[model samples]
Target: MTKKSTIKVEEVNNQIVDWLKSYAGHSKVNGFVIGISGGIDSAVTSTLCAQTGLQVLCVEMPIHQATSHVTRGREHIEQLKKRFPNVSSVEANLTSVFDTFITTVPNNVDAGKVNLALANTRARLRMTTLYYFASVHGLLVAGTGNKVEDFGVGFYTKYGDGGVDLSPIADLLKSEVFLLGHFLAVPQSILKAAPTDGLFGDDRTDEDQLGASYDELEWAMSQAEIHKSSLDFTGREKVVFEIYTRLNAVNQHKMLPIPVCRIKK
Candidate 1:
């Protein structure tokens, strides 16, 4: 895997800010809306939105998250509001909402699958909240998923975090995102903190679910080229390919395009 980066983080930040400005202007939307999860991706994406000098609605939609996670999310949004006049934020604690969904849904699944489904439901709930505010305010829902999560590993939930009008950092790798975060002066705590989806309710992290670190995932992603090449892969390359294939299988559904059936005349 290549350790050196050709992309300039500062330039990327400026370009994304500019893109957001132009997109919102052309689309005639008043501003951008983002769900702040206290992870670096949300922190950087929201900061980039703030940098655009346009109205940015940062919502903290916590669903039975850890106290620390909720606090971090709230504090980050507050910081954005204090620093950027165009930034505004609100909290949508969906504990009751989620509980209602769980209790109301059909109780026909096993315990582990039920937990996974509920976690994903949290993401969909946040997506619903974001679009609700966007519709009310004439804004676009801004997504926080980075390249590794969005494209490489497809770690995001479909129509959940994946449902957004724009993904400002979707092209940025996890490592590159941290670079942009550091450049944008995002809080050091957020930068260094362990990344989590906050979807699993209490304290489960992304890595815990994926069974690999971002660095390893990134490295594993780089092996796709080698996996497809006609040239032979050595022992290490094969091992990495195995990990990549296993992790990537989890995203097969995410990678599938919307199913369409042909209507025969």
Candidate 2:
């Protein structure tokens, strides 16, 4: 696999920043609200929104299981505030909310399903908070999904992390996000930190669930894209076939809206 040195760092950063500014203006959102999980994706999102001169609110929501993550999240937010003095910070403890809801559910469900449901609930709660603040503060919920997560695997929770007014990095690969971070001069600590969802027990990293590295996934996606455009299916056919097959099979839901019918006029 190719290493990080192959990509043009400066060009990606400039393009991303320019696109972010243009989208914010076009959307006419008064500002942006971003959930900062002490992870690179959210950190990058918050930084770019703040740099765009948008009124940014960095929210830290921690359940009992996520206390340490919250502390790290706050530190990153502080770093962002130092760079962009206009940013604001807020804390909302979600422990009680999660506890109450989980306790109400029966324990007979599969452990994996129950865990996923709980994690998804936490994500939706964060979105609810973002929308509530946005409504009162007249801001848009800024999304933090990178292309590798959002497109290649459909890794986001619908109506949860997926509930965004506008996504600035929707087209960026995971590798590109890091390059942009370097350009923004984001703290080395945050840049090097392992990526996590912070929904399960502590130290639960995203890569643990994906079963593959971002570099491999991205290369697969590129090959799949080329195959779609040309339909040759010649060299590298096996790899390209596997990539598209997995993406289509796993991300079927992303291709469809919540199933509903429009009343015929």
Candidate 3:
């Protein structure tokens, strides 16, 4: 069974719409440019931006992306266009661009490190592509990261998927994002699909990479807030807490602002 959120969906939805509209108004940007990855977070974010009646440009930057990801992304964009006249779409196939970068860069490094770096490179390329569209259209690059990724585990790349002009749903957890997606009528294809970054160009899921389910991670996040320890739990709960603390500690760099050297004044 799906867990329920404590938030009032109707109220939260309206608040996000107002927040996006107000931010765009104050920033004096044309609208928002988002990278739609056929995932729940992006689907919900783009939908919220559309509800503001501002121009929303949904761009697909596929760098060896899985077929399912592309299909669902297209489906969501098409449905969103039908529902909101102000929403539009574009496609930027970065497969060749990714190839060129791979060949140009030195590959004498370790294989595992290279693979991970290349996966992050895919996201960085997409980030560059999104900014390109945003600049051309005088729009802001809207990010799709949720609270779990932005705070809990730091699952996103440093300046890749993590890079954005503004975030509409960074405060919401993954489960909360799913709830908001349902309330916004996000396509079932996305809402039903397992969450994946689609950067590795393989079938592995976010759970496979993170070593835990979002539900488990959410519970861990809550428990961590109370300064709970493994002594407070047992079995899988303890195992999950360990995973959460380990990741949260190691990824603090991504979660915090970059440090600068202090100088005598």
Candidate 4:
């Protein structure tokens, strides 16, 4: 069962918009820059940034991306532009760049590790692109990570999708992001599409990589918070809890601050 936050959408929406406006105002930046991935998280995040009525740059960094993802991303960008005058978009096709990088790197390892490394490379390249735009425009790179992925399972790249100037929706879960997305009137194509990182250039979903759905992971997260043990669960629930715990442990490096070696002197 998917557990959704009981947060009041309208109230939370207003709070986030106000918060974004305040943060940008204090930081003396123009606005936000977000990578549109045709997924609910980005759609909702960009919309929230738009609600601030500040400059919001929706960037498309596609590197051998799936057709559906590109289409949905373009659709959402168009819809957002129509609704907000402060919204603008740019597409940075990185296919050739990715191909060049692949050739430059040594791939003596097996195909599996090579593919995984390249996928992460795609994310890092996009991160660099976003920061490039942000630097040029004097805007903040807004992150699209939600609570489940950012906190519970740590399902984001280290400095890739994980890199950002600010996280506007990091407190919300995947389900809560959908709720906010629905309230924000994000494009239906994005709302209905399967969640993907678009890093692998294939149709494989976040679930395919994570071994559990967002809903199941959300449930497991809640159970863990209550100090529940694997013995408390049975069947698929038990399996999911184990999966969530394993990932949460291994990916703590991603979630926590970078460890600095301290001097005992």
Candidate 5:
């Protein structure tokens, strides 16, 4: 059974928008740049940023092999443009860059680690593009991670997709994100599509990697929140214990600052 989210979608959206704008102001950012994955999270984030009167540059960085979500990205961008005339879309193909880097690396590395390295590389590539555009246009990088993904599972690459100047929906859960999308009138198709990171040749979904459905994970996260145990080892007890424990242990890299030693002056 899935635990219901307690947040009011409209209230969360308004609060996030106001908070994001204030963050932008404090950082002296004139606009925002974001990468849209054709997933609901990015769509909702883009919509909120646009509605806030920020000049939004939405980039679609699709590898040549994974073109399935390209059309969806286009439609999302179009909807954004209707509300934010200043919104712009760009296509950045990452195949050549990924290929060149992989070819140069020695094959002695573990294949699984190599694959993760490549995925992280692609994420960094997208971030690099956003940063360059932001620097040129005087905009901030708008992040699209939700609380379920970032806080619960820590499902983000460090300094990769994890890099952001401000996150608009960092506090909202996955279920709440859908509610916010519905309240904002986001396209129904995008809101309903299975969430994916678009990182693999097979076009993998987030649930496949996470070992559970978003509904399940969200429930576990909510329980963890109430229990104040970042790991929710209740209900399904064992399975939840394994998933929560492993994720927290392995993904701790996502939670900490790079270690720096204090030198005596």
Candidate 6:
């Protein structure tokens, strides 16, 4: 039997719509801008923003993106614009930009961590593109990061996916975001698509990089706060615990604000 969500989907939708409108009104921004990655988090967040009846600029900045990823993004945007006149889209292919940066930034230094660095660079490029549109149109960039990525494991890149004017689903777990996606009637393709960062080149998923499923990671994170019992974790459970703590510790820097050197007067 499928377990029902404790959250009332309908009520949650309405409340979030109201909050989006009220916050945008308070900020006096023209509309909300979001990077539509064809994933549940972005799809759900975009739907919520559209529900507010505000102008939403969903940008698809593909840099060496897979064909399927681009197709999914466009399909969702087509549906979004049909349902909400305020929803609009723009495409920014950052391939040349990234290529230029890669060649110049490293000065051909041959760094071993180039792949990971390039992945984060892709995110930052998208971030720059979103902000460019936001600044030109007087919009605020709405982040699509969810709780597990943002707070649990810090899976987002600093000043990349992590940089945004607002984060609508940052409080919701990955499972909860899927729930909201279903409730929002997000594109079936998006709802069914496997969750990925779209940052890694070889089309690796968050699970591939994280070494555990979101459910296990979430469970492990929840247990991190409680006292551990020797019997609490079995073989796989113990592995999950170790993966969670290791990732949590390494990504601690990503979770917090940049450290500043304190000057003593």
The TM-score leader among the candidates is 4
TM-score for all models, in order of appearance: 0.93, 0.86, 0.97, 0.98, 0.91, 0.94
lDDT of 2: 0.78
- Give the alpha carbon lDDT tens digit for every residue of 1-265 in model 3: 1234698888999999999999999999989999999999999999999999999999999988889999999999999999999999999999999999999999899999999999999999999999999999999999999998999999999899999999999999899999899999999999999999998899999999999999999888888998657788788988888898999999999999999999999
RMSD of each: 2.2, 3.6, 1.4, 0.9, 2.3, 2.2
TM-score of 5: 0.91
Error of 2 at 176 (Å): 0.4
Cα lDDT listed for each candidate = 0.83, 0.78, 0.93, 0.93, 0.81, 0.87
- lDDT (tens digit, per residue) of candidate 5 on 94-163: 7787788778878687889877777778889888988988898999999999987787788887887899
* Model 3 residue 127 distance off true place after TM-score fit, in angstroms: 0.8
Weakest lDDT window of 10 consecutive positions for candidate 6: 1-10
> Residue 140 CA error for candidate 3 (Å)?
0.6
Error of 6 at 158 (Å): 0.2
lDDT (Cα, tens digit) per residue for candidate 1, span 96-207: 9998997889978798898888888998998999999999999999999887888777898899999999989998888899888888788777887899987876777787
User: Is candidate 4 or 6 superior in lDDT?
Assistant: 4
Candidate 6 lDDT, tens digit per residue, 1-265?
Answer: 1123377778878888898999999999988999988788889999999999888999999998888888899999999999999999999999999999977875454564787889899999999999999999999999998887988889999999999998888888888888888887888888888888888766788789899988887787678788355256778888888887887789999888889999999
Error of 3 at 192 (Å): 0.5
Q: Which scores higher on lDDT, 2 or 5?
A: 5
Error of 5 at 98 (Å): 1.7
Span of 10 residues, lowest total lDDT, candidate 5: 229-238
Q: Any residue pairs clashing in model 3, and if so which? A: none
> Between the candidate structures 1 and 3, which one is better when assessed by TM-score?
3
**What is the number of backbone collisions in each predicted candidate, taken in the order shown?**
0, 0, 0, 0, 0, 0
Candidate 2 TM-score versus the reference: 0.86
Tell me the spans in candidate 4 whose CA falls farther than 4 Å from its real position: none
> Mind sharing the TM-score for model 3?
0.97
